[model samples]
Target chain A: MKETKKILLNSRPEGRPGDSNFKFETEQVSEPKEGEVLLKTEYVSVDPYLRGRMSDAKSYIPPFEVGKPISSLMVAEVLESKSDKLQKGDHVVGMLDWKERQVASAEELRKVDEDKAPLSAYLGILGMTGLTAYLGLTEIGKPKKGETMVVSGAAGAVGSTVGQIGKILGLKVIGIAGTDEKVEMIKNEFGFDEGINYNTTDNMTEAINKACPDGIDVYFDNVGGEISEAILFNINKFSRTVVCGAISVYNETSLPKSISVQPFLIKKSSMMQGFVISDYSDRHSEGVQQLAKWLQEGKLTYTETVREGFENIPQAFLDLFDGKNKGKMVVKV
Target chain B: MKETKKILLNSRPEGRPGDSNFKFETEQVSEPKEGEVLLKTEYVSVDPYLRGRMSDAKSYIPPFEVGKPISSLMVAEVLESKSDKLQKGDHVVGMLDWKERQVASAEELRKVDEDKAPLSAYLGILGMTGLTAYLGLTEIGKPKKGETMVVSGAAGAVGSTVGQIGKILGLKVIGIAGTDEKVEMIKNEFGFDEGINYNTTDNMTEAINKACPDGIDVYFDNVGGEISEAILFNINKFSRTVVCGAISVYNETSLPKSISVQPFLIKKSSMMQGFVISDYSDRHSEGVQQLAKWLQEGKLTYTETVREGFENIPQAFLDLFDGKNKGKMVVKV
Candidate 1:
């Protein structure tokens, strides 16, 4: 038997998750079963949606149970294998529990070629978040050349990719974030046309109008609530609004008060659509390949706020809600 | 000169338009120029959107000038013609002033044949409001068979047509209205599967759930305040929300405080599209013809809430916000 360190869920938190929500436990890892492979976790991806899974609320995805190790998109190396599909020393990315070592059935993992990109890239830009941004902008947003696109939570993982992709499609990308630093980073480094710091801006509608002078044609919304309502006021006729996430109002015990945008929809003759990445599972490979090509062509860039050790996974996720991470927040377990 | 009684703008009201906002004045008809025709107004259509036009705010259409005769979709008789296309005694429907008789350019009016449907039906079911409901549903809403479809302001002109069309497409049509009488009318007369009166219902969510057991697939929203929010809570996966009008919130000085529905869009992977009738101006005839075919086949049914005389046009328009009229509210001038 080999020793495996696991981060188990101790209890659910009231609002923002804390260290007490998780406990570091040591367990014995046995040999792989007939069709299973043993993987040693290398990197764990922390996302905003994980907070929803922590609670018992009914979401698109199921909730995580108490006393169980939190599962996330992880990059790992095979330590032992009995399955023909994977061999020892193969690096892969799959939905896996937070553990130093664990045995999973062959059906649970997909082998990744290390030569294509960095192993950690599989957990960020070239992974689910990146794919989500790509497909959402192309498939639903339908961004066109010289159009104005406004994205909320623009400094975060998915929002950053969405802004880059909007620029690639020849759209003027305007981003909205919490802090001035993050806003500057999104505009200067991420190649966004402009960035609006929500904290400093008293009138969001005026800020959005100033940023998007031509009126918003495509709105890639991640952080919903007041920001979304503001964007609605400046949308051009026949605008497309992609509802990717609503991190701003997700943790509220009761529904948060928001300005109604429904009337604005009629005024602008616009559209607001909601989407989850899983809905595009069939086109996952297409998104991944396109994003991978963009990365290789130097047309796209990504940033990760990496935390060391498996014990920091909970904190990394908490940092996402705090708007502390500039991009994808990941843990090197 | 021929004498005619016309409805003129008396003054703009501060809240909820009233009869005081209009004044009936007698005017002598002016003779048509070289390329114009004298039109005898038979049916002056009173639509909810006309209320928007009375204000000075920037909108898709320009606001009506104060102290001037209100302009709208009117069915008329060509008493005399100076254009090659039109003749004396020809029935027509066009954008015209609300006078009993007026001179219109030949280019502004389209001939309406009484043989196709009732001449008044051309003003209600085969007119702009009817086309708006038909095209908005088909082009934007895209209601599918067996899907649960919900329409707000379900007793109004567009709402009634939307519900009937939803039923024809094999949809389980659910309607939301302000009063029990309107709710009963929608269910009994318009063929809606169920109706929810928002005024009487304690729990709107529960009422929506009961009405739409499978959840709402298509929500054709005409009223956009609290009713729109209630429907948003019950929308199913991949739902399509077509925003036609927000009659409920149109008169409000400020946007309503409500819960944002952007997260639900992500959960359901849904889309909300706003549309105006003019966007499909090129296909107006196509919509009108399709609606006429359905009406002739006895597959679609419509009702008209007719207010007699041109003097009552302003009151009829105001009656829309009060939910006083069922079906299309038109003034027989």
Candidate 2:
């Protein structure tokens, strides 16, 4: 038997989640049975979407129950393998429990090459984050060349990747971020044509109007609140809005109200669509292949805010709400 | 020279439009120039969408300029033709001004077949009203046969037509209207599966949940305010919302606020799209053909509240805001 540390939900969050919402415990792990592999967790991905799972609300995916082990995308090292598909010492990735070590079925994990890309990347740019930005932009945004594309939460994992992809597609990409530093980073490092520091701007509507003189043709919305309401005014005819994530209002205890989008949509003949990554599961392999190609060609780059030690996982997740991370926030075990 | 009465927009409405906003005057009708036809207006269609044009705010179509003739879909008889395309007494339909008699270029008008359908039908079921309902529902709603479709403003022209088309397409249809009488009319006359009088219902969200037991798969939203917000709670995964019109808030002087739709849309992975009829101009003929076929097969029917006299046009338009008419509201001069 091997000793492992695990984190379970102590209680559901009310408005914003904190350390009290999570309970840490040391547990004993059993040996792998036939068709199972013993995985030592190497990287734990902490994302904003996990906040939705913490609530007992009806969503695309089932909410995580209280007093149960939280699970998410993680990269692990196969310490012992009883399956023929994966041998000992192989690096794999899958939706696994928030534990230091655990036994999982071999079919649940996919092997990752150490020489191709870093292991943590499988949880970010090469995994769900990349797939989401790619599929959501292409399938819904339907971005045409020469059209202007605006991205909200522009310094984060999905937003940064989406803006880069927009540039690759020959679009005039603009980003809206929380800080001036992030605004500069997106323009200088991410190759975005323009950037708006939403925190410093007094009137977001006027700022967006000034930034996008020709009007926004496609909008990748990650923060949905007042910023989104402002973007509505700048949308061009037949513009498409990809409603990816709403980090801004996720912590609100009550229903948030904003200017009605119906009038703007009707006037401009636009479309606003939302999607979970699993909705495009059939085309996931195609998305990964394209992302891999871009990474290999040096056309794609990613940033990671890695917090060391297994004990820091809960803090890492809480940090997302405070805008503490620049890109993908992950915990190294 | 011929004398004709014309109605001009005197001032833009502050909130709800009133008769005082319109001005009527006698003018001399000009003779037909080369390629022009002298048209004697017969049937005038007054719609809720006209309220949008009365404001100076930018919209899908240019706002009706104050102190200029207010124009809409009208059926007219050609008194004289200077073009080879039309003959005298040919009944035609087009976007014509509010004048008893006027001269228009023949190319701007399409001759309506009085023998196939009544001349007035050219302004309702076989015209923009029918086209708006059919195209908006199919193009955006994308209703599957077994799906449940909930329509707001279900007793109005586009909503009634949308609900019937939903039934013809094999969808379970539910409608929400203001009055109990209108609700009964939609169920009995329009053949909706269920009806909800929003004014009488205390909890619209619960009402919609009970009406759409399987949850709403397609929403034909004609009135976009609290009713549309209530529908957001009961939407199933991958549903589509066709934002056809927002008569409820069109006359509001300031921006209307409602519950933010982004969260609901994201949780359900649905789509909310708005469109103008002209966006599908390429498919206009196809829509008219299909609507005509459905009407001739007795698979479809229509209702019209025809108000008589040339002077009552402005009053007829004002009555739309009070929900005084059922289905199409037309003025016969």
Candidate 3:
């Protein structure tokens, strides 16, 4: 038997989660059953959506039960396999228990070839996050060449990938982030045409208009509320807005005050669509393959802000809401 | 020469338009020039969108100039014609000057065949207002059979048409109206599955839920603001919201306080689209032909709140904001 250290949800959080919300435990992992495989976690992804799952609320997916192992997207290596599809030493990515080791059925894990790109790429640019950005952009935000695309939280995993893909499609990409460094990284590293640090900007509408004088043709919204209202005012006629996340209003105790945008929407004849990555589960492989191809071609790049140890998982997850993570927040347990 | 009475915008209103904002003037009709025709206005359509055009602020259409004739969709007779496409006494429908009698270019008018429908029907059921409802429902709302479709301002022109179409498409159509009379009209006359009187309802959300137990799949919003926000909460996954109009917010001094629906949008993986009739200009003929066919088959019906005299045009237009119009408000000039 091998020892497995895991982080469990200690209690339901009302607002922002804290260290007290999680507890670490060690368990003995038994040998794999008929179709099961033992996985040694290489990297665990901590995303903004995990915060939603921590609370018992009606959402796209079910909530995490108190005292259960925190589940997340994990890139792992097969320690032992009893299935023909997966063998020992094979790298995989799947929804896995937040632990140093986990036992899951082989059907739950997708085998990954590390020879194409770095192993961590599966958790960032070529994983669910990347697929989300791709599907949201192509499926909803049908951006045209020379059109302007605006993305909020553009330094993070999904937003960063969306902006880069917009650039690849020959669109002028403008990004909004919380810090100057993230803005700079988006412009210099991710090839964004322009970036705005929402922290310093007094008027987001003016900043957006300044960055996108031709008017925003596609708005990839990650941070909703005031920023989204500002973008709505500047969008061109027949523009498409893709709502991937609303991190800004997630922690509010009461419903946030929103500016009435229906009038503007009517005038512009625009559309705003919201979607979860799972909505495109059937086409996820197509997205993954395209993103992987982009990654191998060096056309797309990703960054990870890895937190060390299973003990730091809660902190790493919390850092996402505070905009402390420069890229994808992941834990190395 | 024939006498022609016209109403012109005397000045731009600061807020809600009053009688003083318009001026009536009489002018002499001149002979038709080459490719021009003399027209006698029969029925003039009064809509809520005209209020937006009166202001200098940029909108979907150009602003109505001060001291100029307010253009509207009107059914008229060709008093004299210089173009071969039309002849004297031919009935026509076009964007014409709000005058009892005037000269219009042949290029601006389309001959209306009264054999298919009444000449006044060109300004209501088979006109821009009808097309607005038709395209907004089919293209934007995308209501599926057996889905619940909720439409606000249910007894008004666009809303009434939307509700009727919803029923024809095998949807359980629920309507929200201001008065009990209008509510009954929607349920009995328009064939809506149910109706909610927003004025009497203590909790609009509760009323909406009770009416649409299956949850709203399509929300045809004509009155935006709090009501629209409430509907957003009850929408099912992959629902579609068509923002046809926001009459409630049109005359506000400043932006109204709205509830944040972004979280719900993300949770439901839904879509909200705003459209102007002009956006479907390329498909105008398609919409008109289909609507005319429906009218002839008696599958669709329309009501006109006809306010007699050219002098009442301004008041008829303002009555739209007051929810006084039972269906399409038209002026007999």
Candidate 4:
């Protein structure tokens, strides 16, 4: 309780960032000011999007400062509260530092009901990741019953939720993942109609075509590369392609190459849209409530690949680009 | 007429096809069956989109069959009608063959009132081209007052109308064209706020940045290549890109390559949509009536590049790739 060990962005990665880019430093814990709470971190999220902030390039959100503590969604337990909104033992989620213990303003954290869902769910399935999946699919994909929906990064947290939502809406869901295990998880666990392991599929386009016999009406593209190129070919007329994340190109040192989409889009009169989750900041709770309801109804399933201890947070984050985790990749401290 | 002269698709184009791909043939005029009308072609449209139909590749519309008359929109004089819907001497527009004379069912053509607008206007402003511009802007662009709207192919039929409509909607309109003459016409005549000559501008992206001090809000992309790439860089958050046409790459035997738009679109949370005018088939009259009203009030002005004689139609169509014509290219037969 006296020491706060935080991960600092030591250096910007040239291509694929690893543990070398992060520095672990320990400091004395500070007292909570008025309207502030001292939180003991229980679970911290390591998302693919964090790779973008690791660079100094301009983006939807500013790049993380080189010397400052890397920040993301963390589920924590309030040990000391100077605010009336939260009390000791209250479980909450906040955009906090990658630290074992930290002080944050009461407004920075929101109380999470542990009785409704697990504490780690607030870092992923019932948090930003879930909202990202819901908003991108619902707002851009515009899912309709009986339509064929294809989602890339099918085994990831957002992709998993997207496929389940598609199924719940009566869509014939097909997912593209990287491994046989992920493929199996999508079909048997997430309730997708079919799954394509792009890593082993001889021809992704043919595999996708076989899975989606009726051409794809909605495509949630999370990995933008050859997989996206494959999806583009099987798109039906007026298909909606939702651009969520392109994890495939996140570590690329050069311009990412893929088949052009303009000609296909023009021929089919289709739409391709890209969005960041921050755009739906106003509708956060709507997604949370709906996701919780589905979870309570036993209609939605989620998987988490948790790495233990505060010292392993950097390795946990580095593992995301390596595709080492299933669903949400979180570190428990 | 006793004889009908037709332009036939001799062979599919192999990388920028020219007049050699067309064959002119003469045949005796056939009689109109019951519920049909015999028509004499007065004005036939030669649009850039026709270049798409010249190939056997799949698209929203069917390819022009070889050894047969190439089909497109034409304004003709109804010489005789056996149906109750039409009478002799009525001027009508319909998707008919590229011939001096032909017979079509009464339901295939809709008579146009020449008193409201010029007969040729039906092929340019008050026709499908104008509708492409209108619907693309109204439905997709969704222009707002005081926002920036940049349109490529600015002097062409659709681009010109898009810019003028942008002006009417109280938007800051910037046009991109091939020639200095077109750049001047878009500004002086069409009332565009500014114009960028892609032919003369060393850097289209820089030129666009200079023309648009405020980032682009809506981009009506008719020529999608480097120009589209340039527009992508300057897009503001939530910007809408209306993919009206990709004339720049229509003739390429290979896939078109430009900068990848995925990253930029993701960062800006923007949308890119491709649509064919025929998608609004049920709402055709709505667009036609609105365009007609704008023409009557002098709110819209159009320029047509007309070539006399059906024999010159092949060359007129070929010249589109060369950027020879100013506005809508039409043949007066």
Using DockQ as the measure, the top candidate is 2
DockQ per candidate:
0.80, 0.92, 0.85, 0.65
Candidate 4 chain A weakest lDDT stretch, 10 residues: A254-263
**Candidate 3 lDDT by residue in tens digits, B204-312:** 9988999899999999999998889889779999999999899998887687878877788899999998989898899989999999888888889988899998888
Task: Give per-model TM-scores.
Answer: 0.97, 0.99, 0.97, 0.98
Show model 4 residue runs off by greater than 4 Å: none
Positional deviation of B293 in candidate 3, in angstroms? Answer: 1.8
For each of the candidates, the C-alpha root-mean-square deviation to the true structure, in angstroms, is 1.7, 0.9, 1.5, 1.3
Best by TM-score: 2
Better of 1 and 3 by lDDT: 3
- Name the candidate, 3 or 4, with the larger lDDT value: 4
Which window of 10 residues has the lowest lDDT sum in candidate 1 chain B? Answer: B249-258
* Pick by TM-score: 1 or 3, better one: 3
| Tens-digit lDDT string for candidate 1 (A1-333) | 489888887887776678888888899998899999999899999898888888887778998889888899999999899999999999988999988899998888888888988888898899998998999888889988999999999999999999999888899999998988998899888999888889999999998999888999999989888888888789998899889898998778787778877777777788888878888899999888999999999999998888998767778887777888878888997
| lDDT on C-alpha atoms for all candidate structures | 0.87, 0.94, 0.89, 0.90
> Between which residue pairs do clashes occur in model 1?
none
Q: Which portions of model 2 show Cα errors greater than 4 Å?
A: none
Order of models, best TM-score first? 2, 4, 3, 1
- lDDT (10s digit) by residue, model 2, range B1-333: 489999999999999999889999989999899999999999999998899899888888899999999999999999999999999999999999999999999999999899888888888889998999999999999988999999999999889999999999999999999999999999999999999999999999999999999999999999899999999999999999999899999888899999999999999999999978999999999999999999999888999999999999999999999999898999999
Residues A181-257, model 2: lDDT tens digits: 99999998899999999889999999989989999999999999999999999999999999999999999999999
Docking quality band of candidate 1, CAPRI definitions: high
Q: Look at candidate 1 and tell me the lDDT of residue A79.
A: 87
lDDT of 3 by residue, A39-142 (tens): 89898899999888988988999999999998989999998999999999999999998888878999989999989877887888888889989999999999
Mind giving the per-residue lDDT tens digits that candidate 1 earns over B1-333? 489988887877665787888888898889988889999889888878888887887788888888898998889999999999899999988899989889999898889889878888888889877898899989988877889899988988889999999888899998888888888999899999888889899989888988778889999988887887888778888899998887776777766777777877887888887789888899998998899999999988888888897767777888878777888888887
